[model samples]
Target chain A: MEEIKKHVLDCSNLNCPMPIVRIAKTIRTIEVNEQIEVTATDPAFKADVEAWIRKTGHLLISYAEEGRSRIAIIEKTK
Target chain B: MEDQKLKEYIDALVEEKVNEKTLAFQNQLENIQQQLSTVQVRENEKITMLVTSFELDKVIPAFIIANGAASFGMDVTLFFTLWGINALKEKSIYKGKNIKEKMITMMLPSNPKSTTISRLNMMGVGTSMMKMMMKENNIETLPDLIDLSIDMGAKLIACQMTMGMMGITTDEIRKDVDFGGVALYIEEASESNITLTF
Candidate 1:
């Protein structure tokens, strides 16, 4: 599905937990059902985000890799 | 008439059994909810640190750990005693050109910035090299971590008895620090889930 993104959180050059920390803070302002894209360089970004999404009941629209960077889109479900 | 009494008695008994089963099921659901609530509380657990190491390597790591936990919304408390209080001091009590005090200041790190590693410090050269390495790796410097800890709400506590024993005046240390004693540290640690001594 082609999901239109409104917010982008660029966490490039950030280390583990920083990206996740920023996402936790940023996701609060987002409206439910609207998609947000998180781009990160941390090798553990995929695993961290996936776990957080699962716990928070958010919708993971899709995930893809770009070069050495990891990108994931999530929609706030609650 | 006897048959009617028997039927009524059976109906009453069945109703009581159904009520008891419903109550038991409701209690089970409550217990599951309580278990989930505890998991969420663990994320916001309290962390307490008793930092006594004045060694540059040890002190820097202490700040990093405390601040890192604080970033995740944990309640962090740092109890500074003896040499640990030196990290919180902005200026040494041994200042103003008193020969003996000056010599003591020279012997010690005096402040967080001038701290040297406990081991492998080759006449201060190793410390400078370590700082350079941290920069190259994008790790926050000791001072940066300390500032972040303060800004992000980590409580910094100084031991009152240690200050008196070492002749350190309140004015020498940062004003933001709260003065406490061993008993105070114990009180805070009693309720803390994570207690670390560095």
Candidate 2:
């Protein structure tokens, strides 16, 4: 098995649009094909991230729920 | 035999003309489809807002949305008109040219920080309480949100007509604010997928 390095973004306690906005901003600082792991407490995190990925043509590698936090691993395709 | 040959030649010519016409129509359809798709892409990539209120609660959401949209890589524009123009005013007191202008300046909130909520202002007491609550909740303050929006590339456009009517000078506004008229707002709003008024 191979290990992949990922950038982590913590959006705990942030409301709507903040998590998505932060994620969008963070994705730009990394290289193409790099992955970002985002953990957010906002309930809409899953849907927001999905829509963002769809609109921006990015890749969502995986998503999960750990208690109150919704986590998403996204890859910058472009 | 000559009549039969003539009839066959006319039929062949008609078939060829019909095929040519069909091909031309298909090309036109494809061109229109391509144009439509381009417009959709542009619409999805932009957002425009008309901020017509100076109330703290209303103005805060405007900046929040602007910052959020900018984060999503959308072209965001905030068109400030009328009372909303106060949100971009400099904190310093402006000495107007005449008494009326001076009164207007004195009456309006000096800047974003001084703005009070539309309801339950209670002579600024409620506004203070709300500010305290926001601070406790870890929400970004209005001034910080405005700065964040600008840093995120959200365009802040002050309505020139409103500024003139209110006797506000370019020096009274923040340095980074852009000044424009209704035409600019329409130009931005026309291409935006989401157009909001606050």
Top candidate, metric lDDT: 2
Name the regions of candidate 1 deviating beyond 4 angstroms: A1-7, A16-37, A44-64, A72-78, B1-43, B95-103
Which pairs of residues collide in model 1? none
Clashes of each: 0, 0
Evaluate candidate 1 and give its CAPRI docking class based on DockQ.
incorrect
RMSD of each: 5.9, 3.4
Q: Each prediction's DockQ?
A: 0.20, 0.56
- Model 1 agreement with the true structure over B1-198: per-residue lDDT tens digits: 999999999999999999999999999999999999988876656889999988878888788678656655578999999788889878776554457546655676667888888887899888888878877766666766677678768899999987776667788888788998988889889878889999
- Stretches off by above 4 angstroms in model 2 are A1-3, B1-44
In candidate 2, position A47 carries an lDDT of 84
Number of the top DockQ candidate: 2
User: What are the chain A TM-scores for all the models, listed individually?
Assistant: 0.90, 0.93
